[model samples]
Target: MSMKNLDRHNRWRNKTVAFRVSPEEDEQLEIFVKLSGLTKQDYITRRLLEKEVVVQGNPRVYKALRDELAAVLDELRRIEAGQGVNGELLDTIHMIATILNGMQEEIAYGN
Candidate 1:
């Protein structure tokens, strides 16, 4: 063989990992793979390597939450310095706290 052919032969990926899946399972896998924007092989390989495969979620919720929390903390600091607090600031803080508490309880008592 030529040098290029010899190098290519030596670098072949000679491993097989196979499994059987039902149509439903195949459909689910394809959905996730498409969302991940990775080829099926790369997706499966990354999963086997325990890489984090991100999927979309309520990003707007989280972003709003983080912004509210920052605002609340800034207001808190101003209050601690004996500055007058706005009623709306207090309301926002209370609302976010309630939502966070609910999430915590759900996590603690998930089905």
Candidate 2:
């Protein structure tokens, strides 16, 4: 058995919840977690609990954002002129936009 873990509230986390996702879904999840600068467990927990995942501005997150943007650009370039855009790509773009907007607001407010 694995060692027990405690949450920020000092509560024991003894239960294990597992679910399967498609490879594509797993990739997307990983991208979001990295961008948020949170552990996979913490990001999943906050998302499952309907809590806001507030991303802190950090070097790691900045790197992830830069890499993701580059990947997105490559994908866009690969698409044929008449081909439809990928929904996942749109979703990723929206997410990145939201994060950037929030960061800008934080800077504006001197937070």
Candidate 3:
């Protein structure tokens, strides 16, 4: 079959997500599914694609981290605006950004 015909036949949703769970777990899932007032597929899709729950963490830790990041960003902007170029400070900021990116990913995935 041609690519055009295949795309038209399957539309955009040609992928499938299949998994198996125990009967007891299935019953529990059904209860929550009914309570959510959404079909099982829609509920599961939303939960997996668009997170409904956030990972738990201490508020103090988040606040401190955010403050530190904001300070770094402010410093970065100031350094960029200044006549002198500070390579070391810029490298430090880049490293911190990379580490924070990893931490964000870990928190998002509940790791």
Best by TM-score: 2
> Which residue ranges in model 3 land beyond 4 Å of their true spot?
1-11, 53-111
Task: Give the whole-model CA lDDT for all candidates, comma-separated.
Answer: 0.64, 0.90, 0.58
Q: Which candidate, 1 or 3, has the higher lDDT? A: 1
**Order the candidates by TM-score, highest first — what do you get?**
2, 1, 3
Q: Write the per-residue lDDT of candidate 3 for residues 1-111, one digit (tens) a residue.
A: 445433324655446789999876675566445434455766687688785723233554355446556766776688788756555445545544554576689879988
Judged by lDDT, which candidate is best? Answer: 2
What C-alpha lDDT does candidate 3 achieve relative to the native structure?
A: 0.58
**TM-scores vs. true structure, each candidate:** 0.45, 0.91, 0.35
Each candidate: RMSD:
17.7, 2.1, 19.1
What does the lDDT come to for candidate 2?
A: 0.90
True-vs-predicted CA distance for residue 59, candidate 1, Å: 1.8
Deviation from truth (RMSD, Å), model 2: 2.1
Relative to the unseen true structure, what is the C-alpha lDDT of residue 20 in candidate 1, on a scale of 0 to 100? Answer: 96
- Name model 2 segments beyond 4 Å from true: 1-4, 80-82
Off by over 4 Å in 1: 1-57
Candidate ranking (lDDT, best to worst): 2, 1, 3
Candidate 1 has a TM-score of 0.45
Model 3 lDDT, residue 105, Cα: 93
Worst 10 residues of 3 by lDDT: 53-62
